[model samples]
Target: MDDRKTLVLTGASRGIGHATVKRFSEAGWRIITCSRHPFSDKCPWPAGEEDHIQLDLADPDGLGTAIADIRARLAANGGRLHALVNNAAISPKGEGGTRLNSIETPMHLWRAVFQVNFFAPIMLGRGLVKELKAARGSVVNVSSIAGGRVHPFAGTAYATSKAALAALTREMAADFGPLGIRVNAIAPGEIDTAILSPGTEALIDDIPLRRLGSPKEVAEAIFFLCSDASSYVNGAEIHVNGGQHV
Candidate 1:
Protein backbone atom coordinates (compact mmCIF):
# COMPACT_ATOMS: atom_id res chain seq x y z
CA MET A 1 0.00 0.00 0.00
CA ASP A 2 1.14 3.53 -0.74
CA ASP A 3 2.17 5.61 2.26
CA ARG A 4 1.31 8.99 0.78
CA LYS A 5 -1.58 11.09 2.09
CA THR A 6 -4.78 11.43 0.03
CA LEU A 7 -7.31 14.19 -0.59
CA VAL A 8 -10.75 14.17 -2.19
CA LEU A 9 -11.53 17.63 -3.49
CA THR A 10 -14.63 18.91 -5.26
CA GLY A 11 -14.62 21.51 -8.06
CA ALA A 12 -11.00 20.87 -8.94
CA SER A 13 -10.98 22.13 -12.55
CA ARG A 14 -10.27 25.81 -11.86
CA GLY A 15 -9.75 28.71 -9.48
CA ILE A 16 -9.07 27.94 -5.83
CA GLY A 17 -9.71 24.26 -6.41
CA HIS A 18 -7.01 24.09 -9.05
CA ALA A 19 -4.57 25.89 -6.81
CA THR A 20 -5.34 23.49 -4.00
CA VAL A 21 -4.71 20.50 -6.27
CA LYS A 22 -1.36 21.97 -7.18
CA ARG A 23 -0.48 22.66 -3.56
CA PHE A 24 -1.29 19.15 -2.38
CA SER A 25 0.23 17.45 -5.36
CA GLU A 26 3.52 19.25 -4.87
CA ALA A 27 3.46 18.02 -1.29
CA GLY A 28 3.28 14.42 -2.58
CA TRP A 29 -0.37 13.73 -1.66
CA ARG A 30 -2.68 11.79 -3.95
CA ILE A 31 -5.61 13.88 -5.18
CA ILE A 32 -9.00 12.64 -6.33
CA THR A 33 -11.21 15.31 -7.85
CA CYS A 34 -14.94 15.74 -8.49
CA SER A 35 -16.49 18.31 -10.78
CA ARG A 36 -19.56 18.85 -12.92
CA HIS A 37 -17.50 18.86 -16.09
CA PRO A 38 -15.54 15.97 -17.49
CA PHE A 39 -11.79 15.86 -17.01
CA SER A 40 -10.21 18.57 -19.12
CA ASP A 41 -6.63 18.71 -20.30
CA LYS A 42 -6.64 22.36 -19.32
CA CYS A 43 -6.08 21.41 -15.68
CA PRO A 44 -3.20 18.93 -16.27
CA TRP A 45 -2.25 18.39 -12.64
CA PRO A 46 -0.41 15.23 -11.61
CA ALA A 47 -2.72 12.22 -11.51
CA GLY A 48 -5.59 14.70 -11.27
CA GLU A 49 -6.77 14.21 -14.85
CA GLU A 50 -7.19 10.50 -14.44
CA ASP A 51 -8.93 10.63 -11.04
CA HIS A 52 -11.57 13.18 -11.99
CA ILE A 53 -15.19 12.21 -11.36
CA GLN A 54 -17.86 14.07 -13.29
CA LEU A 55 -20.95 14.96 -11.27
CA ASP A 56 -23.07 18.07 -10.93
CA LEU A 57 -23.51 18.67 -7.23
CA ALA A 58 -26.39 21.11 -7.71
CA ASP A 59 -28.52 18.36 -9.24
CA PRO A 60 -28.93 16.74 -5.78
CA ASP A 61 -29.58 13.42 -7.48
CA GLY A 62 -27.51 10.24 -7.51
CA LEU A 63 -25.29 11.37 -4.65
CA GLY A 64 -25.26 7.82 -3.44
CA THR A 65 -23.44 6.78 -6.57
CA ALA A 66 -20.88 9.55 -6.18
CA ILE A 67 -20.18 8.54 -2.59
CA ALA A 68 -19.78 4.94 -3.66
CA ASP A 69 -17.44 5.80 -6.48
CA ILE A 70 -15.34 7.98 -4.20
CA ARG A 71 -15.09 5.23 -1.63
CA ALA A 72 -14.13 2.71 -4.29
CA ARG A 73 -11.39 4.98 -5.57
CA LEU A 74 -10.02 5.49 -2.08
CA ALA A 75 -10.05 1.75 -1.50
CA ALA A 76 -8.19 1.19 -4.70
CA ASN A 77 -5.44 3.50 -3.51
CA GLY A 78 -4.64 3.25 0.22
CA GLY A 79 -8.11 3.18 1.79
CA ARG A 80 -7.24 6.35 3.67
CA LEU A 81 -8.53 9.83 2.91
CA HIS A 82 -6.67 12.68 4.59
CA ALA A 83 -8.81 15.59 3.52
CA LEU A 84 -12.13 16.45 1.85
CA VAL A 85 -12.36 19.99 0.51
CA ASN A 86 -15.87 21.17 -0.31
CA ASN A 87 -14.99 23.81 -2.88
CA ALA A 88 -17.84 23.42 -5.36
CA ALA A 89 -20.41 26.20 -5.35
CA ILE A 90 -23.00 27.86 -7.59
CA SER A 91 -24.51 31.36 -7.39
CA PRO A 92 -27.16 32.22 -9.96
CA LYS A 93 -27.93 35.77 -11.03
CA GLY A 94 -30.26 37.58 -13.37
CA GLU A 95 -29.27 39.83 -16.25
CA GLY A 96 -27.57 43.19 -15.71
CA GLY A 97 -25.75 42.21 -12.48
CA THR A 98 -28.80 42.09 -10.22
CA ARG A 99 -29.17 40.55 -6.82
CA LEU A 100 -31.51 37.62 -6.22
CA ASN A 101 -32.59 38.45 -2.71
CA SER A 102 -34.70 36.27 -0.47
CA ILE A 103 -38.03 37.34 -1.92
CA GLU A 104 -37.05 37.24 -5.58
CA THR A 105 -34.96 34.06 -5.51
CA PRO A 106 -37.07 31.16 -6.86
CA MET A 107 -37.58 27.96 -4.86
CA HIS A 108 -35.90 25.71 -7.43
CA LEU A 109 -32.87 27.96 -7.58
CA TRP A 110 -32.68 28.05 -3.78
CA ARG A 111 -32.75 24.26 -3.58
CA ALA A 112 -30.08 23.91 -6.21
CA VAL A 113 -27.74 26.33 -4.46
CA PHE A 114 -28.19 24.66 -1.09
CA GLN A 115 -27.84 21.22 -2.60
CA VAL A 116 -24.47 22.11 -4.02
CA ASN A 117 -23.00 24.49 -1.46
CA PHE A 118 -24.33 22.96 1.73
CA PHE A 119 -25.91 19.53 1.44
CA ALA A 120 -23.34 17.96 -0.82
CA PRO A 121 -20.57 18.66 1.67
CA ILE A 122 -22.63 17.17 4.44
CA MET A 123 -23.22 13.99 2.47
CA LEU A 124 -19.63 13.64 1.35
CA GLY A 125 -18.15 14.31 4.79
CA ARG A 126 -20.45 11.98 6.67
CA GLY A 127 -20.29 9.33 3.99
CA LEU A 128 -16.52 9.18 4.25
CA VAL A 129 -16.18 9.58 7.99
CA LYS A 130 -14.84 6.08 8.24
CA GLU A 131 -12.05 6.74 5.80
CA LEU A 132 -11.22 10.08 7.44
CA LYS A 133 -11.07 8.43 10.84
CA ALA A 134 -8.76 5.81 9.51
CA ALA A 135 -6.37 8.53 8.43
CA ARG A 136 -6.99 11.00 11.31
CA GLY A 137 -7.99 13.43 8.62
CA SER A 138 -9.44 16.89 8.33
CA VAL A 139 -12.19 18.40 6.16
CA VAL A 140 -12.03 21.97 4.88
CA ASN A 141 -15.26 23.53 3.66
CA VAL A 142 -15.07 26.58 1.39
CA SER A 143 -17.34 29.28 2.71
CA SER A 144 -17.77 32.95 1.75
CA ILE A 145 -18.00 36.36 3.40
CA ALA A 146 -21.59 36.61 2.15
CA GLY A 147 -22.42 33.79 4.51
CA GLY A 148 -21.90 35.91 7.59
CA ARG A 149 -23.21 39.21 6.26
CA VAL A 150 -25.30 40.64 3.48
CA HIS A 151 -23.48 41.35 0.23
CA PRO A 152 -24.97 43.43 -2.56
CA PHE A 153 -23.76 41.09 -5.32
CA ALA A 154 -24.16 37.62 -3.82
CA GLY A 155 -27.57 35.97 -4.10
CA THR A 156 -29.57 35.19 -0.96
CA ALA A 157 -29.55 31.45 -1.67
CA TYR A 158 -25.79 31.44 -2.01
CA ALA A 159 -25.23 33.42 1.18
CA THR A 160 -27.61 31.41 3.32
CA SER A 161 -26.28 28.13 1.97
CA LYS A 162 -22.76 29.18 2.96
CA ALA A 163 -23.92 30.19 6.42
CA ALA A 164 -25.48 26.77 6.74
CA LEU A 165 -22.27 25.19 5.52
CA ALA A 166 -20.31 27.02 8.18
CA ALA A 167 -22.73 25.76 10.77
CA LEU A 168 -22.34 22.25 9.38
CA THR A 169 -18.61 22.51 9.83
CA ARG A 170 -19.12 23.10 13.52
CA GLU A 171 -21.54 20.22 13.73
CA MET A 172 -19.19 17.89 11.89
CA ALA A 173 -16.29 18.86 14.11
CA ALA A 174 -18.26 18.24 17.28
CA ASP A 175 -19.45 14.88 16.06
CA PHE A 176 -16.24 13.70 14.45
CA GLY A 177 -13.74 15.00 16.97
CA PRO A 178 -13.90 11.90 19.11
CA LEU A 179 -13.04 9.87 16.05
CA GLY A 180 -9.85 11.89 15.48
CA ILE A 181 -11.23 13.92 12.56
CA ARG A 182 -11.24 17.71 12.41
CA VAL A 183 -13.59 19.83 10.31
CA ASN A 184 -13.10 23.50 9.54
CA ALA A 185 -14.11 26.13 6.96
CA ILE A 186 -12.44 29.04 5.15
CA ALA A 187 -14.55 32.05 4.08
CA PRO A 188 -13.05 33.98 1.19
CA GLY A 189 -13.80 37.59 0.48
CA GLU A 190 -13.51 39.29 -2.92
CA ILE A 191 -11.36 36.89 -4.94
CA ASP A 192 -10.42 37.16 -8.58
CA THR A 193 -12.27 34.34 -10.21
CA ALA A 194 -14.55 33.76 -13.16
CA ILE A 195 -17.42 33.85 -10.68
CA LEU A 196 -16.73 37.53 -9.99
CA SER A 197 -18.63 39.78 -12.33
CA PRO A 198 -17.11 42.71 -14.23
CA GLY A 199 -18.52 45.42 -11.98
CA THR A 200 -17.03 43.91 -8.84
CA GLU A 201 -13.73 45.74 -9.32
CA ALA A 202 -15.27 48.99 -8.11
CA LEU A 203 -15.48 47.58 -4.60
CA ILE A 204 -11.76 46.89 -4.39
CA ASP A 205 -11.02 50.10 -2.50
CA ASP A 206 -13.21 48.95 0.38
CA ILE A 207 -11.03 45.94 1.05
CA PRO A 208 -8.21 46.56 3.51
CA LEU A 209 -5.89 44.72 1.20
CA ARG A 210 -6.95 47.07 -1.62
CA ARG A 211 -7.00 44.21 -4.09
CA LEU A 212 -8.86 41.06 -4.86
CA GLY A 213 -7.37 37.97 -3.17
CA SER A 214 -5.74 35.44 -5.41
CA PRO A 215 -6.92 31.84 -5.64
CA LYS A 216 -3.49 30.79 -4.36
CA GLU A 217 -4.01 32.64 -1.09
CA VAL A 218 -7.29 30.85 -0.48
CA ALA A 219 -5.69 27.52 -1.35
CA GLU A 220 -2.90 28.13 1.16
CA ALA A 221 -5.42 28.73 3.90
CA ILE A 222 -7.21 25.51 3.00
CA PHE A 223 -3.91 23.72 3.04
CA PHE A 224 -3.15 24.96 6.56
CA LEU A 225 -6.47 23.75 7.87
CA CYS A 226 -5.72 20.31 6.40
CA SER A 227 -2.15 20.15 7.68
CA ASP A 228 -0.61 19.18 11.00
CA ALA A 229 0.05 22.87 11.63
CA SER A 230 -3.66 23.27 12.31
CA SER A 231 -4.04 20.10 14.31
CA TYR A 232 -5.30 22.04 17.32
CA VAL A 233 -7.92 23.85 15.23
CA ASN A 234 -11.40 22.45 14.75
CA GLY A 235 -14.94 23.72 14.22
CA ALA A 236 -13.62 27.19 13.35
CA GLU A 237 -13.67 29.34 10.24
CA ILE A 238 -10.58 31.15 9.01
CA HIS A 239 -11.54 34.18 6.95
CA VAL A 240 -9.25 34.68 3.98
CA ASN A 241 -11.15 37.79 2.89
CA GLY A 242 -8.49 40.44 3.60
CA GLY A 243 -10.43 42.01 6.49
CA GLN A 244 -13.63 42.43 4.50
CA HIS A 245 -15.74 41.17 7.38
CA VAL A 246 -14.09 43.42 9.92
Candidate 2:
Protein backbone atom coordinates (compact mmCIF):
# COMPACT_ATOMS: atom_id res chain seq x y z
CA MET A 1 0.00 0.00 0.00
CA ASP A 2 1.13 3.54 -0.71
CA ASP A 3 2.26 5.20 2.51
CA ARG A 4 0.54 8.44 1.68
CA LYS A 5 -2.95 8.99 3.15
CA THR A 6 -6.01 9.13 0.90
CA LEU A 7 -9.30 10.99 1.31
CA VAL A 8 -12.62 10.60 -0.54
CA LEU A 9 -14.37 13.95 -0.56
CA THR A 10 -17.79 14.82 -1.97
CA GLY A 11 -18.99 18.23 -3.23
CA ALA A 12 -15.51 19.09 -4.36
CA SER A 13 -16.37 21.32 -7.30
CA ARG A 14 -16.04 24.49 -5.26
CA GLY A 15 -16.31 26.23 -1.87
CA ILE A 16 -15.33 24.31 1.26
CA GLY A 17 -14.82 21.11 -0.67
CA HIS A 18 -12.42 22.76 -3.09
CA ALA A 19 -10.49 24.32 -0.23
CA THR A 20 -10.22 20.94 1.48
CA VAL A 21 -8.89 19.29 -1.70
CA LYS A 22 -6.22 21.98 -2.02
CA ARG A 23 -5.23 21.67 1.63
CA PHE A 24 -4.91 17.91 1.57
CA SER A 25 -3.10 17.99 -1.78
CA GLU A 26 -0.59 20.43 -0.30
CA ALA A 27 -0.11 18.15 2.67
CA GLY A 28 0.96 15.33 0.30
CA TRP A 29 -2.24 13.32 0.69
CA ARG A 30 -3.93 11.76 -2.35
CA ILE A 31 -7.45 13.10 -2.85
CA ILE A 32 -10.45 11.68 -4.74
CA THR A 33 -13.23 14.20 -5.29
CA CYS A 34 -16.80 13.78 -6.59
CA SER A 35 -19.35 16.28 -7.80
CA ARG A 36 -22.48 16.49 -9.93
CA HIS A 37 -20.74 18.60 -12.55
CA PRO A 38 -17.79 17.58 -14.70
CA PHE A 39 -14.40 18.94 -13.79
CA SER A 40 -14.03 22.41 -15.19
CA ASP A 41 -11.48 23.10 -17.90
CA LYS A 42 -10.30 26.06 -15.90
CA CYS A 43 -10.00 24.07 -12.70
CA PRO A 44 -7.04 25.46 -10.82
CA TRP A 45 -5.95 22.02 -9.67
CA PRO A 46 -3.90 19.87 -11.99
CA ALA A 47 -6.07 17.79 -14.29
CA GLY A 48 -5.83 14.00 -14.65
CA GLU A 49 -3.26 13.82 -11.85
CA GLU A 50 -5.84 13.65 -9.10
CA ASP A 51 -8.97 11.51 -8.95
CA HIS A 52 -12.22 13.26 -9.85
CA ILE A 53 -15.61 11.58 -10.24
CA GLN A 54 -18.86 13.00 -11.55
CA LEU A 55 -22.11 11.86 -9.94
CA ASP A 56 -25.14 13.40 -8.35
CA LEU A 57 -25.49 12.39 -4.71
CA ALA A 58 -29.22 12.76 -4.96
CA ASP A 59 -29.27 9.60 -7.09
CA PRO A 60 -29.61 6.93 -4.43
CA ASP A 61 -28.97 4.01 -6.73
CA GLY A 62 -25.77 5.51 -8.16
CA LEU A 63 -24.19 6.07 -4.74
CA GLY A 64 -23.25 2.43 -4.40
CA THR A 65 -21.60 2.43 -7.81
CA ALA A 66 -19.77 5.63 -7.02
CA ILE A 67 -18.45 4.24 -3.77
CA ALA A 68 -17.30 1.10 -5.52
CA ASP A 69 -15.47 3.16 -8.13
CA ILE A 70 -13.78 5.16 -5.38
CA ARG A 71 -12.71 1.99 -3.62
CA ALA A 72 -11.30 0.58 -6.84
CA ARG A 73 -9.33 3.75 -7.45
CA LEU A 74 -7.88 3.61 -3.98
CA ALA A 75 -6.88 -0.03 -4.42
CA ALA A 76 -5.32 0.72 -7.82
CA ASN A 77 -3.26 3.49 -6.27
CA GLY A 78 -2.14 1.14 -3.49
CA GLY A 79 -3.65 3.44 -0.90
CA ARG A 80 -6.32 3.12 1.75
CA LEU A 81 -8.94 5.76 2.23
CA HIS A 82 -8.38 7.42 5.61
CA ALA A 83 -11.36 9.76 5.59
CA LEU A 84 -14.78 10.49 4.13
CA VAL A 85 -15.99 14.10 4.04
CA ASN A 86 -19.71 14.51 3.42
CA ASN A 87 -19.91 18.10 2.29
CA ALA A 88 -22.53 18.07 -0.42
CA ALA A 89 -25.88 19.71 0.37
CA ILE A 90 -28.56 21.85 -1.20
CA SER A 91 -31.00 24.35 0.31
CA PRO A 92 -34.60 24.40 -0.74
CA LYS A 93 -35.19 26.09 -4.07
CA GLY A 94 -36.97 29.45 -3.76
CA GLU A 95 -36.12 29.44 -0.06
CA GLY A 96 -34.50 32.85 -0.09
CA GLY A 97 -37.75 34.72 0.39
CA THR A 98 -39.53 32.17 2.55
CA ARG A 99 -39.75 32.31 6.33
CA LEU A 100 -39.11 29.36 8.58
CA ASN A 101 -42.78 28.34 8.77
CA SER A 102 -43.93 29.78 5.49
CA ILE A 103 -46.85 28.00 3.85
CA GLU A 104 -44.75 27.74 0.69
CA THR A 105 -42.47 25.16 2.30
CA PRO A 106 -43.59 22.26 0.17
CA MET A 107 -43.03 18.58 0.79
CA HIS A 108 -40.96 18.25 -2.38
CA LEU A 109 -38.62 20.93 -1.12
CA TRP A 110 -38.20 19.10 2.18
CA ARG A 111 -37.60 15.82 0.41
CA ALA A 112 -35.02 17.34 -1.93
CA VAL A 113 -33.23 19.01 0.93
CA PHE A 114 -33.16 15.84 3.03
CA GLN A 115 -32.14 13.70 0.09
CA VAL A 116 -28.82 15.51 -0.30
CA ASN A 117 -28.20 16.86 3.17
CA PHE A 118 -29.23 13.97 5.37
CA PHE A 119 -29.78 10.76 3.42
CA ALA A 120 -26.97 10.74 0.85
CA PRO A 121 -24.13 11.22 3.31
CA ILE A 122 -25.49 8.69 5.77
CA MET A 123 -25.88 6.10 3.03
CA LEU A 124 -22.44 6.76 1.60
CA GLY A 125 -20.80 6.60 5.00
CA ARG A 126 -22.48 3.32 5.80
CA GLY A 127 -21.35 1.85 2.50
CA LEU A 128 -17.73 2.90 3.06
CA VAL A 129 -17.50 1.94 6.73
CA LYS A 130 -15.45 -1.18 6.16
CA GLU A 131 -12.65 0.60 4.33
CA LEU A 132 -12.72 3.43 6.83
CA LYS A 133 -12.62 1.01 9.78
CA ALA A 134 -9.65 -0.84 8.36
CA ALA A 135 -7.73 2.42 8.06
CA ARG A 136 -9.02 3.78 11.39
CA GLY A 137 -10.49 6.63 9.35
CA SER A 138 -12.86 9.38 10.35
CA VAL A 139 -16.12 10.76 8.92
CA VAL A 140 -16.71 14.48 8.96
CA ASN A 141 -20.22 15.69 8.28
CA VAL A 142 -20.54 19.32 7.28
CA SER A 143 -23.46 20.85 9.14
CA SER A 144 -24.83 24.27 10.09
CA ILE A 145 -25.69 26.21 13.27
CA ALA A 146 -29.20 26.36 12.00
CA GLY A 147 -29.42 22.75 13.06
CA GLY A 148 -29.13 23.70 16.72
CA ARG A 149 -31.18 26.86 16.71
CA VAL A 150 -34.38 28.31 15.40
CA HIS A 151 -33.36 31.00 12.97
CA PRO A 152 -35.44 32.81 10.40
CA PHE A 153 -32.55 32.84 7.95
CA ALA A 154 -32.57 29.06 7.76
CA GLY A 155 -35.61 27.54 6.13
CA THR A 156 -37.48 24.67 7.80
CA ALA A 157 -36.26 22.05 5.37
CA TYR A 158 -32.65 23.16 5.49
CA ALA A 159 -32.49 23.52 9.25
CA THR A 160 -34.34 20.31 10.01
CA SER A 161 -32.20 18.25 7.61
CA LYS A 162 -29.04 19.59 9.17
CA ALA A 163 -30.30 18.79 12.63
CA ALA A 164 -30.88 15.25 11.49
CA LEU A 165 -27.35 15.18 10.09
CA ALA A 166 -25.93 16.28 13.41
CA ALA A 167 -27.85 13.54 15.15
CA LEU A 168 -26.59 11.12 12.54
CA THR A 169 -23.05 12.21 13.31
CA ARG A 170 -23.47 11.33 16.96
CA GLU A 171 -25.05 8.00 16.15
CA MET A 172 -22.29 7.10 13.71
CA ALA A 173 -19.65 8.07 16.19
CA ALA A 174 -21.14 5.83 18.83
CA ASP A 175 -21.54 2.91 16.46
CA PHE A 176 -18.14 3.31 14.75
CA GLY A 177 -16.00 4.30 17.70
CA PRO A 178 -15.64 0.73 18.94
CA LEU A 179 -13.97 -0.08 15.62
CA GLY A 180 -11.48 2.79 16.00
CA ILE A 181 -13.36 4.97 13.57
CA ARG A 182 -14.04 8.57 14.53
CA VAL A 183 -17.04 10.64 13.51
CA ASN A 184 -17.48 14.37 13.95
CA ALA A 185 -19.24 17.42 12.55
CA ILE A 186 -18.59 21.05 11.75
CA ALA A 187 -21.38 23.61 12.01
CA PRO A 188 -20.48 26.71 10.09
CA GLY A 189 -22.40 29.96 10.41
CA GLU A 190 -22.30 32.27 7.44
CA ILE A 191 -19.58 31.18 5.11
CA ASP A 192 -18.78 33.05 1.95
CA THR A 193 -20.06 30.57 -0.55
CA ALA A 194 -22.20 30.75 -3.65
CA ILE A 195 -24.52 28.31 -1.91
CA LEU A 196 -26.08 31.23 -0.08
CA SER A 197 -28.79 33.02 -2.02
CA PRO A 198 -29.15 36.79 -2.42
CA GLY A 199 -31.25 37.60 0.64
CA THR A 200 -28.59 36.19 2.97
CA GLU A 201 -27.20 39.67 3.50
CA ALA A 202 -29.95 40.43 6.02
CA LEU A 203 -29.02 37.29 7.95
CA ILE A 204 -25.32 38.10 7.82
CA ASP A 205 -25.94 41.26 9.81
CA ASP A 206 -27.17 39.17 12.74
CA ILE A 207 -23.90 37.27 13.08
CA PRO A 208 -21.73 38.71 15.83
CA LEU A 209 -18.61 38.46 13.72
CA ARG A 210 -20.10 40.79 11.13
CA ARG A 211 -18.21 38.92 8.39
CA LEU A 212 -18.36 35.57 6.73
CA GLY A 213 -15.93 32.67 7.14
CA SER A 214 -13.70 31.56 4.31
CA PRO A 215 -13.85 28.11 2.79
CA LYS A 216 -10.24 27.54 3.77
CA GLU A 217 -11.10 28.17 7.41
CA VAL A 218 -13.77 25.49 7.39
CA ALA A 219 -11.42 23.13 5.55
CA GLU A 220 -8.81 23.64 8.25
CA ALA A 221 -11.15 22.28 10.90
CA ILE A 222 -11.92 19.29 8.70
CA PHE A 223 -8.24 18.55 8.21
CA PHE A 224 -7.62 18.55 11.92
CA LEU A 225 -10.47 16.14 12.53
CA CYS A 226 -9.33 13.82 9.73
CA SER A 227 -5.71 13.81 10.84
CA ASP A 228 -3.99 12.29 13.87
CA ALA A 229 -3.81 15.74 15.39
CA SER A 230 -7.30 15.14 16.71
CA SER A 231 -6.75 11.55 17.70
CA TYR A 232 -8.49 11.92 21.03
CA VAL A 233 -11.36 13.94 19.55
CA ASN A 234 -14.35 11.89 18.47
CA GLY A 235 -18.10 12.39 18.43
CA ALA A 236 -17.58 16.11 18.87
CA GLU A 237 -19.20 19.03 17.09
CA ILE A 238 -16.86 21.90 16.33
CA HIS A 239 -18.55 25.25 15.80
CA VAL A 240 -16.86 27.49 13.25
CA ASN A 241 -19.47 30.19 13.40
CA GLY A 242 -17.45 32.99 15.00
CA GLY A 243 -19.55 32.82 18.20
CA GLN A 244 -22.79 33.05 16.30
CA HIS A 245 -24.45 30.46 18.49
CA VAL A 246 -22.75 31.18 21.78
Residue 57 displacement in candidate 2 (angstroms): 0.9
lDDT of each: 0.91, 0.84
**lDDT value for model 2:** 0.84
lDDT by residue for model 1 (1-246), tens: 768899999999889998899899988998989999899888757776678889988665677788889898889766789999999999999778789999999999998998999999999998999899999999999999999999989999999999999999999999999999999999999989877877789888889888999999999999999999999999999999888888
Predicted candidate 2 versus true structure: per-residue lDDT over 2-70, tens digit per residue: 787888888988889989888888888878888998877655654423578898888887888998888
Task: Please give the RMSD to the true structure for each candidate, in Å.
Answer: 1.1, 2.1
Local lDDT at 113 for model 2: 83
Residue 184 lDDT, candidate 2, scale 0-100:
99
Top lDDT model: 1
Q: How close is candidate 2 to the true structure, as a TM-score?
A: 0.91
